[model samples]
Target: MATLFDEPQKFPLAERLRPQTLAQYQGQAHLVGKNGVISKLLQSDKVPSMILWGPPGVGKTTLARLIGNHVKTPFFTLSAINSGVKEVRQVIEKAKTRAGSILFIDEIHRFNKAQQDALLGAVETGLITLIGATTENPSFEVISALQSRCQIYILQPLSPETLVEMLENAQKQDEWLKKLNIKLKETEALLNLSGGDARRLLNLFELVVSAFPANQDPLVITNEWVLSTAQQKTVRYDKTGEQHYDIVSAFIKSIRGSDPNAAVYWLARMIEGGEDPKFIARRLVISASEDIGNANPTALVIATNCFQAVTMVGYPEAEIILAQATTYLAASAKSNASYMSIKKAKELVRKKGDLPIPLHLRNAPTQLMREQGYGKGYQYAHDYPHNFSPQEYLPEAIAHTTLYDPGQNARENELRKRLKNLWQDKYGY
Candidate 1:
């Protein structure tokens, strides 16, 4: 009996329940709350160009749409995936005709420098209020000029309470979903699978409900049902996209945090999702130096070997190599001292504008150079006791500065003692 005009039940649960206004929006209370910056902006007439940076399904696009609706502006949406520079120009040309228009670009981080540049004039001239949505870090992906013009607002993942509330709201608001006699017996599986993505959570919930037999009286949502249904509908992880970066980040952080179990879990996720083995290996190698450092120098060797092994062996077998490296890095005593010291040293060089190298430390390759006092007083450390000379090595301007602060780990502790003994109070070891 369904007519063309009749409400279609085929629409996705998430789409059907999409918030029409800011008032109905479920999460991001920090942004939409009474005194929040976004709320304040909405209260006013002016809608500034902004980039909403957050995880997937945190409602960046929804917020942009709500802002357009609230301001009653001509709204145009373009996806960075399919849209190019040509499309960007077309949109801007159309916006020029309208007095006040809002251009929303989803996955804006995917836009190339040239495509993003296309938006600069429109956003800068106030021809179109640009609202960009990105799941990736904008600093890395967005060009400086375009990024400078737009305000960045960070949206956090939906909390468990907020997610549950969203689910309840869907049941209450959606006529089709409301018709079912449903009870949520468990939510941990749903929450775990969603990974704080609101849209994915709703879609998974719908899939579970649809699995129930029509003759079944009460629809029971359990962890088992959710897991089974989810397995059948495999989780969509785009290895070349946002999820790739997210999983790699988690993997690196797990090792950095010294959680072998978590490190291995994320590594497995990447491997199973068919992520490039070399890419994962490269990150592992970086983590070995940056996070593990001098706490276990062997970690770098192991990570390097793992990378080579994976490159030679390839996947199926490569997963084992990656897992081995991941666990070793996680188990090793961690330190960022070496990494931080290099960063500080680099910063000093940049600030000091290449301070002159000390005369004593300079190499006197020829007689004329030696006559100019080059390497004149450079103490031979091998001739000194303990093969150590407490001499000035850094540029004269920063000679007294201590860049390498040894961490408190056992190995670095010994290093600290040695440096302290050699330098007395010179380097403040």
Candidate 2:
């Protein structure tokens, strides 16, 4: 049916496999399934203005299209990169006359605050059902009023299983793929290279298929081929792109993993690629608090000082401070005990709602407060021996909440030994 002379297509898979209905879309079962919010809204025909946030190739755009299709309303689309506020106003004007209209804006985060504000009126007045898609966090990029008016739903990266299922489905369904006698010898290569991006996976799949020499029976796709083909020199690592996060992640992991050599390499990669030195320093600050933690209390102090010095000094000069902090963090003993402990404590506090403060711990600055027994049983540690008084800080209901479990590193060992002496029953160091 298909000829060899056919021209290579720009969006072969994405366009062909574009889900015309919610049922055809893969992944995001949370929003499109039977009990999903989007499904319920569609059934009742109550389409609301909303924002979709997600990583690349997560069907954010496709889901927006699917919603537009199912809603029985006029739909218009705009790309924030090329469109200005003028285009936004034009769409709004059109939507004013057309009742129950949807205006979808892709990369809505790229729109500046002013451009985004232009949409607020149309969205608030129901002139258009706003469907905004953003790869960035809306809290950071979107205006407060605009964000408040739109319900935000985060779309997740396609699972490895879902990605593999898509590839297998394409192989079975695509005439060109089947005609080529394609056999995926290894999926690890594809999955690794795609980084869980479905569009990237399908594009790579198409590439491997097309690269196979003519007359080769049962064309096998191997890791070596995938690696070689996908080995593209990344364009000047833009901190705004996914590679930015990936490289920063590698840099931090290298430091956390105690590989100063790899850490410096990633650091250089980011710096030479024009990453903000302050941004790098900020991550170091966090790495110091999170990974290096109580293993080296000096780490937090050093990183904090570095951040301050870098902020005052600026780049080129600031780079030295970053390097100094990075090296120290890389060479330091690592511990995440404090980080995990606080995270767990915060999670409990959030889940259990606002818990009452311990009566003894509360301040009795007023006479009426003292009458309520506030600070009645409070102990003055400074007045006690060794300037240490064993007392409960958490609420009585959460008295047993064992947060901040220090690790067994040298610095924490000192804390562990001292704490055990003060509170023998608790803090099983």
lDDT of 1 at 9: 61
lDDT of 1 by residue, 149-177 (tens): 98999999889999998888888988887
lDDT of 1 at 40: 91
lDDT of 2 by residue, 1-429 (tens): 443225475567756666688877889889887888898989998988899998877898899888888877889999998998999999988887886699999989889888998988888888899999987778867899998999999898789999989988887777666666777788888887777778768887777666655556777788887777666733346555445667888999999999988898898888877776766887898999899899998999999899889879987888788888898899999999999998998998988878899889899999999999999999998999999888888777777677888887899889888888888877565
What pairs collide in candidate 1? none
- Candidate that would win on TM-score: 2
What lDDT is obtained when candidate 1 is compared to the true structure?
0.86
Whole-model lDDT per candidate: 0.86, 0.83
Model 1 TM-score (2 dp): 0.70
Q: Give the per-residue Cα lDDT of candidate 2 at 15.
A: 64
Give lDDT: candidate 1, residue 362.
88
